[model samples]
Target chain A: MSVENLAISFGSNQVLKSVNLELHAGETLGVIGPNGAGKTVMLNIMTGILKPDGGRLVFLGRDILKEGVVERVRMGLGRTFQIPRSFRNMTAYENSLVGAVFGSGLTERAAGARARDILDMIGLSGKKLEPAGKLGLLDRKRLEIGVALATGPRALLLDEAAGGLTESEVAEILGIVRKVKESGVGVIWIEHVLQTMLHGTDRVMLLAEGRDVICGRPRDVMSSREVEEAYLGAGVGARTRRKRA
Target chain B: MGARTSGIRQIGGAPGPRGGWAARKPLVLAAAVVVLALLPLYASDYGISVGILIFLYMSLGQMWNLLAGYSGLVSLGQQAFVGIGGYTLAMVTQAYHMSIALSFFIAAGVSLAFALVISFPIFKMSGVYFTVGTWIVSEALLVFFRNWAFVKYDAGYNITVAYRISMPALYLGALAVGLGATALVYFILRSRMGLALMAIRDDESAAEARGVRLYRTKLACFLISSVYTGITGVVLYLNITYVKPGAAFGIDWTVCMVFIVVIGGLGTIEGPVIGAVIYVILRQYTYNFPGISMIMLGVAAVAIIMLAPEGIMGAVHGRFGFRLFSTERRPPPGTGPRQYPEDAADV
Candidate 1:
């Protein structure tokens, strides 16, 4: 999957002026950015939650810029929200069942099997009867990814899946992402946790001010002077200015 | 504890929501239908009248539940379809001198078409705006029908043929509609579309991301709901033998639907059944208090909503961990519960 020169704006606030990225099969492409860097916006456009003002999104040799969200999911592009959005009133099993039945258009019996497999995979088999609204944050986050995976997508877009987890919980999330990548599904992981991108990704892209500041091997990109000036350097300068003020 | 575990299995079984008495649901439903069908034969005239009210409100409340509880479309203008339905019966039977059989189909067709037409504007709004927008459309229609020469201006049209139909037959018709409405909700909730509808209700964008088509599913639900509401209206007007702009298109119908669904249960299948019974009994008793009746009903609705926000059925389900007419899909057998870390259960 590839996106080129994607852009969007609300009112006069230009969210994504122009952004580009590519994900090869079975690769984990980590996207790291500061607050309001258009990471979620880009994911939204790719998933068809929000339309890009101008861009090209090519998946499997087809320019799917015109496709809607459901059409995209059917075409094997699945996504999780930045703030986990599982169907709260439903059971954990039923949440996954929705994706298996509608996202993949499986028959009821087949969907039932698929949903069970997903819950087992996500380690929610015991809590299958529990309502999703009753699940803890870690479980809810796991269910978010589990629901997306139930669609049987070739590529998965995860938005801050480890946002509020503890160190061990974050490791568990990384383990699942590795398992997903090992299964030959391409991944675009947007994260604020620098360590995750450093160790978990095959490649890293730095997005600041709605533009790709750098993209390369994670370590190489992290060590670059441009990254320091745009990311850490800006942070230091802001703090020093605040101290003086 | 043992009972609770078995209850879990009953709901979680692969064939869906069956075990013990639940396994005999179909037989029970059939027997109830038989009894209701035979009701007018043994019941008095006043008893038959109350029975008709129960059936009609059940039909109306179920449709409202399907719209607000399942599809997440809270429409306050369902009265528009009801009014349209009653007037269609009047025009077909009285104005065109058509047979009663043809009028039922015409009323449904007209209501379905109106639903489609209003859906364009109303669907554009969401949440509270959609609610108000639907009420506005219904009010606009009320005004349109009042002045339109075709509907006899302010006077309204009467279904003269209603006099030709016997009370028992009308009761039978209401029985069919009430049973049909319940059956329709049951089957729809059990279908794959039912999952989609609940998903949409829970979260629209998430539902869409999971490949549930939003507009198409909503439109289908709206159309089905309107057709049933229209048919119920026909049965209602047939009973009264008179249709007027003020009464046929009044906000009273929407109030009854909302009251019944809210007081019984918002989304549960059994909610409307219980709600309709309570509503009918209250309405019948309140006739002696004429002026304060609407206020009394309002007070009753508020009290019920305050006590059981999910309605009586929801509160019952919470306390007992049981559901009848459930739309839940549980894991297959043999997938024993997995253990979670101790801290995970803290929340």
Candidate 2:
């Protein structure tokens, strides 16, 4: 139900230091921070892609400090990368099939059925047979989402889902996440695109220099002085600081 | 429509176009072997030799497919094991005077064991480093075998029995082994073990996170691959009635296997078959042309990589919804998007 004092250290650098955060059963938490503020690191730690040095990580009221990425996924937790990770040799459809069989626990035929349906839903049905290596940015992003969705997570963590999208494309993806939330799945999205986060999420969690600077309503948190001086300062820079703050 | 399309997902389960490939593959395989069994009875001497060579490479290529293609290890020195297998068979059968079949089995066993022992050190290296380490290992093996001289490094063979260009018995034996190897690859890919292999290929860390005990999977793949390649070496030496360190441990074999699997379809079941058939035909006809064969093969590899990186299996998958032989499925709609689920439905 919540993260309890999760901390992670990569080599000498302690990326996350005793970070405690949570989301309600039906809420979206937007994570925003400076580039190296450990936003993606925090997501990796949560998904068990990276191990924590100290502190506890709980998923659905169970300790997940030691579970691996796929185990965490099987425990109803899933995530997508900032840069989409797909099997280059497989088709868009086949890539999702991997998620279905391994991540979603579907039988062979059932997995194909589900993968086809997911591709269709993501507007990748026509491109499903195309090699994943040949896909453009938008379709690759969609494929990333489709693969993650195939795992069927109760709580999905997205890392920069709209990184390279046009504004309209961003809005389209924002709608997809919103629809996902409607299916009773909890979402925590990290994005540098502030407006998309502000307009899309029900709540917001701002990470700064490996720590949570602000957590609450998106607009309120975005407008907070600590966030402005640290996160938005990094985003909007010192020149526009006064007006934005 | 997603729901309706989901119903059609059952199409692959039926034996519609591709034959009863899934269920009766064993029987079909047996029949093919029987056909091969009768080949020497009617075939000309040259035809038998060509057929035997095809069987040998098919075995080598399938094993190479497991190591280089599915596991993404991409070793360029697998010929070292081929040398080891041939020499071991030759020595044991010659000096020790063991049975021919026993010599082949022992060689396979030794190579499999040896490969398992070294996999850990080799795999510890990063992508290209792993490949380089294997190459060095093979080269070192070649040097050692050549210098030992007790195994007749220069002159090659000391077969007590005079043999034809090719024998019916050896061809039949090679045919059986080749069929077994392809079938073995098919079974491994279709099983949970193959899943672990693919997981390692696609994303190593992700597979580890999912409790895919990497050491065991990697060891199994290496050992199985070594055994097949090793057996081929035995067959190769026996057919020629000679075994030399240089010829037995030649890099050409490994290179050819890689070329075949790469062009056929790197990760698909049928890729190696297509690749092997094409490569064998080219090799059979191109010996007198010298380096031209290598140049053409190299050009073909570059073209395949630049144009069709996924190879023919991927092309088939892209053009039609045909897996041909892959057991992997596309995660269907309503199954949710991720591969693993807390519950079965993933809903």
Scored by DockQ, the top model is 1
The DockQ values of the predictions, listed in order, are: 0.37, 0.24
lDDT of 1 by residue, B1-347 (tens): 99998898777864554465677877887898899999999999999999999999999999999999888899899999889888989999989999888878998999988999999999999889999999999999999999999999789776789998888999999999998899899899889889998898789889999999988998899999999999889898899888888888888899899999999998888999999999999999999898999899899889999999999998998888677677788777645433221111111
The lDDT leader among the candidates is 1
- State the iRMSD of every prediction, in order shown: 7.1, 5.4
Q: Mind giving the per-residue lDDT tens digits that candidate 2 earns over B307-339?
A: 778887668777885764556544334544432
Alpha carbon lDDT of each predicted model: 0.87, 0.76
TM-score of each: 0.90, 0.78
- For model 2 the local lDDT of residue A26 reads 51
